[model samples]
Target chain A: MTPDPAAASAPGVLVTGAAEEEVLAAVVVALRRLCAGGAELHLRAPPVLDASVADRAGYSTSFPHLLGAVSRGGAATDLVLTPAACYHVYPLFEGRVLAAPAEVSVLADCHRQEATTERGRLRSFRMFETVRLGGAEDCLAWRDDRLDRLGHWMEALGLPAERRPANDPFWGRPGRLLASAQRADRLKWELSADVADGVRQAVVSVNHHKEHFGAAFGIRTADGEPAHTACLGVGLERLLLALHHAHGPTQERWPTHVRDALGLTRSCTN
Target chain B: MTPDPAAASAPGVLVTGAAEEEVLAAVVVALRRLCAGGAELHLRAPPVLDASVADRAGYSTSFPHLLGAVSRGGAATDLVLTPAACYHVYPLFEGRVLAAPAEVSVLADCHRQEATTERGRLRSFRMFETVRLGGAEDCLAWRDDRLDRLGHWMEALGLPAERRPANDPFWGRPGRLLASAQRADRLKWELSADVADGVRQAVVSVNHHKEHFGAAFGIRTADGEPAHTACLGVGLERLLLALHHAHGPTQERWPTHVRDALGLTRSCTN
Candidate 1:
């Protein structure tokens, strides 16, 4: 499991255990099942994003101050570290027409320069994401299905989680309005659980980008309409923290409900 | 599974299916078993490392031109994105005395600015590392045990792998000498496999730092002797590429032996 980035005592260090390994495995398998048979591939978005593309995608407008940039043969503002996992997928589909809705999943560490560094508020965090792209209605339906499936999985795992309207940590005064609008439009929903030290945090999210990415990347549906996109992502470290709070420091002492949900086997460990 | 960074056909992307999930899970469990029931905890190193630490760790000496620095607060060179997964462990042990031999494991993405973007050389790649710190003789023994265990895992997975003396892509003429010395001392041993496009690449490395890390970080063993350290790490993306090369593109089509070693169960995926 990933470590708490904000915990000053343990900031930016990962410590994993047997139960953590099991949960990580269980999470990956469950997410794959939700992908509806995705062809697994690996991706690493250029750690630095193209400033112009990010600008078109509302990155600089949303959080101009938080970008982590590199001096890699571009203007100072030409590139910034990617802020989101799904963003990279859109670029790959640039100018492409989908034959059908495609589902892709990624397990990668995302970076952000946040104002807060509280334990668990990681600067770089591990995430397992399932991203679906296609028709507007199909994407929406898939999002709904996944949201429901995630709820069921967590319930079986004995992780007390609640899905509620949420907003990204967008920046500044303008960001406040954007956040509120996002909440009002119900563009995002997070499955939040109590984590280390009884602090509440969002462990999973179901996000719909409507036509933002499709228009920005010039991606279209099979019928030549702007593609709709929805992404479901689980914060691996946060999930482990929630499990630790619920089951104890490790998985060995986890309750039968939790253990059953993880569905661990002897082959998984002794 | 992640793709090769250098491969233009699938640059900077990771994809996985049910079988791949099983493989990753299997690898983790296998590694843990090799740890001989490591009573160790997981740690997450801060993603952004202090530039001075990287400098002192001989990163600048090794690759002077390929550093990824952040323009966020402080001077241009004060901080940088972490380039190696094991570097973080050494700093944490600074000014500390180990009661006994200690071992830690990390699963994190390491950054490098590779001049050549080959299909298999990822600029930002994920690494799973096991770092052992203790007496010179004990650490060496542990390192030997790990190297042998790794060989067995690769064979069991049906990957034709060979261990050979290796050198880092050190920079310039002076760095060339360093690389030669490293190989001469048998400091770095890589398990090479034929990956993407039948190119032989390194997937695992067992590195013995001797007292380098201990001396740099001021870490002393129980008897006040500078500790010796060794790191065993797997480049997950490269391994995945090798698996794809040998087992075919989709994990579903992989051989029974491959699937079995992954310990795939219906419970893991239907």
Candidate 2:
């Protein structure tokens, strides 16, 4: 019997076997190269973040529907499962003034309470993120550059993906305005690919936070202005799912170019 | 200013730099070699576990004080941040009968709500676990064999540690009996090392569960008997903390043998 991808390991949990792990490693290497230079890789981040930090990030208020809290005996604790990887990076520079642009690469096991159990909508997932922080122009420029590169990376991997304007699923009516404003400001863009039969999902998200976190955390730019931030996150599991959907669940048969792009050498069985 | 390891990245989060990452990779390689053959490596698992799984594992009943629940708002969700890596392994074999012994190596970001926050007692930590499930004789034999090998591995790494009888922090009065019984039966052993000044913490835990998980999850051996289970877990960050305490904080200044054992070549700098 085949293992249910979501429940194979645990609910909303996707466990990677040898072949999948190889592909993920290759993908990460490719991503780091694509990021070029000056990116510091923070190999691990806590799966949980402080509740106050989450509140300051406006996550609890902006997307309460997707939030998950850590508790003891059904009573709320001061911690929450990290909703995003970049959340860990921002707090590291709290109340600090950056002399130059900072780019940090982080990988975190992120959690979200999903209402759906679709192929790509996992409750728990791995987020491969790169966060850039500095002046507004630098952050926005980096976001734009990485967005295009990520779109091209997907194409190079033989994934039929599109880069499109997007918005977070903010909750309620006020959220609707926020979503509208986000789109109007071009604050978010996603690289989406089909992970099921005609069911497309966003595998890569490029977000620009215009002083939202900087103002909240008191991170200032060289000129004493609130530092702007941008992040690019790749949902590793969803990307694997997309690859499986596109290439018959087997990596050997994938196009040669795609394999080379991902550094999946012929000898790399595992 | 040095960042507080606990709060550097986030509360209970330990972020690894380039050098630390190198050491960890080397350590994993050595552990895998020590495990020998017939081991399947599961590279990733969900940070959260289903509440039912936790209940069946007796984790909540035994260690209620250390349990962390995943909730939405203040209400409990069906999920809990995984307390251990082996919890993810059992569900995979649910209702299955194994023809041969199974050995699975898994790495998961585990969480615990400890009453204290010290260098080794992290709220969130990485657990590198290998679970063996089969006949009682095979399980216990494998547990004992691996326990000694792990102890030797720590010694080879130049960490002064001790392997001693240990018991889970079972809850309440009835739990005391369970702890005493466990100790009397020699069911649990830990490799404890000094993580701080006079603070010795358990960096590795080896436990044998005689038919506990197998019966709960309906797993059976070839003879149709409940499969026995045993697990060996290395608290990766704690080991790192221990290494820092034993050797100097700088990997370059560590004993040549220790650095060589960890594959931290002098030329290998972050």
Candidate 3:
């Protein structure tokens, strides 16, 4: 079945790499393709060492300055990539994009057994709920960073963009704490008609969380405050599934769009 | 750090595929490798008809027939592989061991977004809970059909092999349900010690889902229960951070295990 045109055009792909190697491989391939096509790439790297390192080295430093070294190059960079053990940390690298070699690759390896457990799931669920409700602004702040980045990319490309606060219904409504809590974090963007093409062609990366199941895109209707936005996820396997769905398995016969996105040239045999 | 020798010897790997093509690609490659070594393979495939067709053919009729086809291959087949989506309909496929094509692979394309999501970190947690509740036994039973086939291969090869219930604590406990009630509609698997080595050596066919977060595997303890498992997930961009962590991006070398697993045989030329 055809996906909703809106979703198809504004597709959001979700990719998972089984291991660190696979994740990097997919990202590296994507970066190479994007950069090679002259698409501006953004890189964000949050320092692993804390300010204590500066004290040890006899260097007094501000967090911004320390982070600046990591975030420099902004739009000049071809990819914005960072390591975040926790999702909350992702926003710290916001506003700063770095430049690196097209071939440069990062590897984040985590063991599932190590990271997840029944207890862990429960803790995460609790933490997620708590932070989401108690720290609504913080959550909005994280989301803002991403939305702002999209704005930045648009500006860099000289595309017309517009930012408008959505008239979200749940923004100030009271009843359920979760409902009131959700309003604490909300942001929306509407690109100018001129950049509609760019927005249509653009792909937004969404980091998955359980909360995402409820609100994947964070978009809400003017009156339908809780009406979550539609997100287009690219299931690593499902993408292949889509490929098979649209085209056959043979790489030679893959859709031109997919091939181009993946930077896969037709093999002579194909 | 070196993984535990016992763990390494009995390493468990989970490979997710996107579509049947990608799944087949990964399986074929893995099978070729194992076939050359004359190794035995076990597999399990749950019955999953196309959604459109599922309604017409009740699951009872569909599942057994599918299982029968897989069992018909008997001991000659060295590896086992199956569609993960089947698990959604047939939760019983979890604990059972099956004779696969000498290699096992699952399509992980659907999990790309899930892997990278905040919830992705909870994969192990999900596995632990799923197994602990004995919810995976039915899935295991489904898988056992194929394991029985593999047993035939072992018997024919004069290889000492036996199938016994795993005693992993994670798979033995019963617990209150967590996550959304809808999760009950999805399929689940528990790891078994007997299946760990095959999983590790097996090449997982990933799409974007599994690639986004990391790779996940199921593990079984001595009591035939799925205890602890691991998912080697690295955010695509996080890898670069990790590289910086281990050694500066320039003139760097990853840990031996990391390098070996990724098949990164060469130094960074760029």
Give each model a TM-score.
0.79, 0.94, 0.28
* Overall lDDT per candidate, in order of appearance: 0.70, 0.84, 0.24
- Candidate 2 per-residue lDDT, tens place, B43-108, comes to 556688888899998999998899999899788888888899888888888998988888888777
lDDT of 3 by residue, A3-38 (tens): 121121001111111232232234334533332232
The collision pairs in model 2 are none
> Per-residue alpha-carbon lDDT of model 1 for A201-243, expressed as tens digits?
8888998888888988788987888898888888878888888
Candidate 1 residues lying further than 4 Å off, grouped into runs, are: A1-15, A31-56, A70-82, A98-100, A137-163, A172-177, A196-198, A264-270, B1-21, B34-56, B71-79, B141-163, B172-174, B196-198, B246-270
Q: Which ten residues in a row have the lowest lDDT in candidate 3 chain A?
A: A122-131
Off by over 4 Å in 3: A1-28, A31-87, A91-252, A255-258, A266-270, B1-104, B107-166, B170-262, B266-270
Docking class of 1: acceptable
Which rank order by TM-score, best down to worst? 2, 1, 3
Predicted structure 3: lDDT? 0.24
Query: lDDT tens string, model 1, B13-83?
Result: 33333455456656665565665357365654545576677877878667866666766432253456667
